[model samples]
Target: MPLYDYQCSRCGEFRAFRPMRDSQLPQACPECDVLCERTLSAPFLSGASDGCLSRPQGAAPGGSWRKMCGFGCSGAGCH
Candidate 1:
């Protein structure tokens, strides 16, 4: 299974992952109950033989953390 990041359309931020065949919907927001979006992401902690490095969310391509956590925009897009 791959680790993924998901943002709540209603709430804020959250992370999630499951079987590649599984659903990508959030049950509820840690802050509030709302839907979320799934974002395919890059490796957060590279357990490579070299060393481990933590990349910030929305970083570059390979070093980037996906933000499928719903629309980060405000206004009517709120779930």
Candidate 2:
């Protein structure tokens, strides 16, 4: 099962776990019981720093691998 985000007009947004087959189906809001549509959301990367996804790779001003990748990379096998 994968977690997805849904938005209800009355109750705002919420997350739910469902199979991929049901991803396109509308989900009932837990708070208001109203059918809500699935919303587009970005994947959350654990331990990732802010701006990691916003910037292109190797585009950091300082050119540090850690800052460029936002992963505090150790330079081992890193391009």
Error of 2 at 75 (Å): 33
Which candidate's TM-score is highest? 2
Candidate-wise lDDT, in order:
0.42, 0.58
Error of 1 at 79 (Å): 31
- Off by more than 4 A, model 2: 45-79
Residue-wise lDDT of candidate 2 within 1-79, one digit each (tens)?
A: 5667677676565666779999999998766688999988875444633322222433433233234443443343333
Candidate 1's residue-wise lDDT over 33-60, tens digit each?
Answer: 5666665565556332221112234433
Determine the backbone clash count of candidate 1.
5
TM-score of 2: 0.55
